[model samples]
Target: MEKIKNLQHSSILFGILFLFLFVIGSGYYLLRKNMLQNHKAQREIIVLDIQTKVESLLSALLHSYTLKKEEIQKKHKEVLSFLQKCGCDPLRLNLTPLYQKLNANYTPPRYNIYITDENLTIKNTTFKNDLGFSLRFAKATFDKHAKEHIIGVSTPLLEASTQKFFSYSDSYIPKTDKILQLSYTYEASSQRFQKIQHFLHKMGIVRATSYIILNDGFINKIDFATQTKEKLAQVIEKNQEDAKKILKTLQTKSRSIRQNKDLQTIYFVVDSPILKDAKVLYSITFDESDFYLKLATLKIVFLVITLFGVVGIIFLWYLRKKEIKLSYQEQFLRSAMHEIQTPLSVITLNHEMNTLKTGENEFTKEITNALQILELSYNELSFALLATKQEHKVEKLSLVEIVQKRVSYFKAVAKSMQKKIIVESEDPSCIMISSIELIRIIDNTLSNALKYSDPKSTIKVEIKQSNLCISNKGKKILDTKRIFERYFREDSAKGGFGLGLFIVNEIAKKYDIKIKVNSTDKKTTFCYHFKEAECI
Candidate 1:
């Protein structure tokens, strides 16, 4: 039985430990998972923010490049109209001063003009310069979109000499069938670029590279909007492997944002197609050091809190384990004491019978009462261990007989210790209580009075109609109020579990018996005053 009880207690502790571990582990996992999920959302927002800014800027740049077509065609029509009004043909026109006067009227129009004949050969015109050179290179561009009686623009063109990029347009006249084109060179440091730069600044992608790629494989960089003056292509070329991938990916059909990965850094590139075969590929290097630092700090804080919670649970488990052990040990003691009490009663009864039959000296009345008191102590211990009290059965038991029986029981021991016990009753009466419980109550009080009373000093047991009391002249009780408390002792020098008066008080209460203790410097008295029992 003891082994089974121990195993059960052990099982309970193990179960409690496992439950604590499982809860802590699950809480930690969920906390970290939630933090990571939030971090993921933040990262996506950062990426989306970068991509949206680049897309919007590219759209504006494409519009600017394409819109120049209309402006160029408009300027060219003015020249052609002036030529017809003066009755001049493209092959024979010599109006340098008129062209100069027309150009002078424009203010801050950072562009150039050109004139070409049917085969795109430079015709007789005013103010010739190498600025209109890429027009000859883009002859096929005009030829493909050339229409009679129509004016239109060309795809972007690159001047290899100066790295200047521009777009041109052509107008066809039915009167002379002369095909004339105008070239509008791009200003890299234009106010339009400033607008794009301000927009990039708003988007938080400050360190970025932007460029326009031409159909001829030459790059026209957007330098004015970048943080540094270094060319976009040159910076990308520093990482040869990523540069190849970046340039190659820009040519694919998927003109979406792409990644360029190197040993130490990552770049995001998006290419937006502008003209027939040209595109603007924009790339920005991703900076995630701040993001990582914040995430690491969050994890560390959660771990610290989680560590404290786990330690708290372990500490609680330790306290709970102690409580369970105390409970189990108390249960075993109760069971052991209860088993011993049953045989003790049998031995006590048999010894009493033998003494009456043969007047035998094997066990005297003193030894019998001692064993009986020991058995009563076991019963009290059993009740205390169970965290319960003995509910005494009340019946009319004569106090005169109880006192005489207890006095006779203690008489031999009193003589051996040279102490005399006197039972004086003004009125012998009946106490309503269980006979067994009454015996324990009388025995515990009598035992204490005998043990502590000065040897040869008479201890007095008195009985009355309403009460019984035992008075002893011995060591005074330091705390009269605490004598009836369980396991309480004024002097530990006296050997006992200190349960004697406590049990006496318990039985007294069950029978509606009020216990009172009065102590002086050298005299102490314990009295039990019973109420009248309910009559049948």
Candidate 2:
């Protein structure tokens, strides 16, 4: 039976513990999933932003190049017309004045004029270094176009030239059999172009490597970490396998991603009117090490918190076990008290009958006294058990009458101790209370007075309109504060279990009865205020 009860109690704790774990586990799982999804979305947005900015930059570069080429063509027409006005005579024209007039139209004038013979060899030139240099590719361009003026892009002849390619226009000077050439090289060192390159270098993507492959096969690497040592623009050979693979991937899909270990590479194809039939491939590699680190940190923190929660549940289980054990002990004590009542009543009844039949003796008187004391202790235990579990029958009773009746009952027990209980009442006062509980309260207080008072002391019991007080001349209660605590005894040698006052307090509290204790070196008083009372 005891094992079953214990199991029943444990089952409740187990149920609560299971519920706690399930709630915490589910919460952690949902939170972790959400965090991972949000992190992936944030990374995608950042990558897309980089792709957009790179496209915008490529458009700007194409526009600048087109503008520079158009300016060079316009200068070619102006120079050709100037030669015609001089009557096709190179000696008759002042080159200095013509150069000044053309240079005034542009910032940092970077134009030069050259005259080439029928053999494609430079005859006269504004730049001194190229005076006799042969134009290897100019003749093919001039014959294919078959026009008076031809504009085309040419690779740099001088290895030390800062520009990879330059724009030049060739015009035939009348009757001279000489081609006038005007060339323009857009310098990469120009302030405006340099600032754009610097902005692209510091594009602000962390742990990412990005590059753009232009139509001209030039790769503009935007990796900021090693950008200082590498050129922003460099031509990639057609045979380079890496560039070929990137171009192949971009052709297959407008956008595609390939993941390797912790890095994911994205290939995006940029479409613009500037590149026309040619495609620009923008590729970026993203490192996900930081994302993994944040997820790992989240897991560790959740584990620590879960560990603490489990410990707290275990602690609660321990406390619950102790409470169950204490409750069982109390149940056992109440059962034992019920068993003692029947036999105790029979013994008291038989003794009274024997004393009535035969004359009383000192031995019988002593037995009677002992039985009364036993009965008093038994009544206290009975009241404690019944008052807590069952509702009592209530009635409007006279407080003065109840006090007088209890005093009379304990008068014989008091005489054996050489003490007496006296009742004092000014008028009849009535209160609505349980009869059994009221008798128990009056009986226990009188019994305690008889037991603890001086042998010859008079215990004064007074009843006013709405109050009852019992004052006895005896040793002062040293710990009056705890006098009404169950099982608390100031002096265990007094021969009572100390439950008398505790029971009184419990019953008083049930009906809103207020109790007060006043103790001194000479006397002690227990007073109860019956606030819900009427006087006649």
Candidate 3:
């Protein structure tokens, strides 16, 4: 029996698809995790870079301020020394005319200089208005600190928006009982830094790009809103919260990823190491959507490539499995076909020898039975070898004769089983069919009759009206409709390939013979009805 449990193509397809999806899904999940981790690393790099920028900006601003203070001190010393050498007292001399002399004294036409008495009273002025800022801040700062440095003041108050940072350094003159003040503003550098809008666009800096640099003790400074590489600046008011928070909480630099669930945002706060000798917090807030957008295209391409490659690999593997399975089945069938030949030849030769010597005895019948069974096995092997591509050779033959030959062929089998075939044929029952095909039909019908019939029962084989009918008194076919289908068997215990009946039907159809089946509780009959037949 050919127990070919062949895997169906559809089943292979479904399995491959399932495997493909599982593999791709797992791969996709891993890739996404990797991409997310890489994104975090990239964000850290950007944060560190921004922090470095802020630190450098701070250093440059401190240096610029220190330079401005030193320049003011240098200029003030020069003016005061010249005034003392000329026997000039800034308070006693009509110093209002000294403004032009002072202007001419400096090559770059120095900052507005003024002389004021130590009692915080303005005595001389660059412009009479002087905004009173120079006197107020200079005196308040001078009296407040035991140690004196540049009185860097914005105005009478920190928010006083002259948009200028004033650096005031005063020199006391013993001959004058007055102090000379030199002041300058960073308005030029601030304006130039604010013009970095184009450069900011190039760097992909968005509205969220903001930072604060604390000046430690000073309330007046420039903000990054007008920041440049030349100067790091920040407004005191803008930094008040962070500055106060740091002073109160002293939060350290954090490297962990922080998330805001409500806002669906992530960020990092880098506390730069006391930049320019001042503690500062430089945090960069980024909307996650931008980074997602950046990864979206890459992710799409990756998925497409991965899916395509995975499907290709799975399909190839499926094909390989199918090919290997078929290869093994074919190899086994060939090996079986080859392996059975020696026994088959021995049985056939023994049957022939025994038939010649004993002339129709029971032992000779048994040998013939073995030979007949061997013949069927050989034919089945041939059929498997052919894979159903047998050469056709049509001939005119008497239908009754072919039926007799097949009945005689199965006679040993029938006798061993204690069953008999009763043949009734009319004269000249000739048909045009491949002789091999006709033998196949007759042998299959007779074999089924002997296999399924009750022992000692009669099988009636009749060829009348150019039609053959084989009827057996045996177990009735439960499903006559499917009895002739390949691999279908009414009784699996009666071992055969189950190919016989199906071959009968197919050959009958090919030769334009109509086949039918009729089954009852008592009898089952298979008919091969010839059409368009001619007989003499």
| Leading candidate by lDDT | 2
lDDT by residue for model 2 (11-106), tens: 577677778778878988998899878966975786677656545545655565667766777888788787888675563345777677777866
lDDT of 2: 0.69
Model 2 scores worst on lDDT over the 10 consecutive residues at 231-240
Which sections of candidate 3 miss by over 4 Å?
A: 1-211, 217-256, 260-280, 289-340, 343-347, 361-367, 386-408, 415-442, 456-492, 497-536
Candidate 1 whole-model C-alpha lDDT, 0 to 1: 0.63
Expressed as tens digits, the lDDT of each residue in 65-128 for candidate 1 is 7666666777777877876687756566665655565457556444454556655566644436
C-alpha positional error of residue 288 in candidate 2 after TM-score superposition, expressed in Å: 14
Instruction: Give one digit per residue, the lDDT tens place, for model 3 in 441-473.
Output: 887778888888888999999888778889999
Error of 2 at 118 (Å): 33
lDDT of 3: 0.62
- Candidate that beats the other on lDDT, 1 or 2, i.e. the better one: 2
By descending TM-score, how would the candidates be arranged? Answer: 2, 1, 3
TM-score of 2: 0.57
Clashing pairs in 3: 222-233, 222-234, 223-233, 223-234
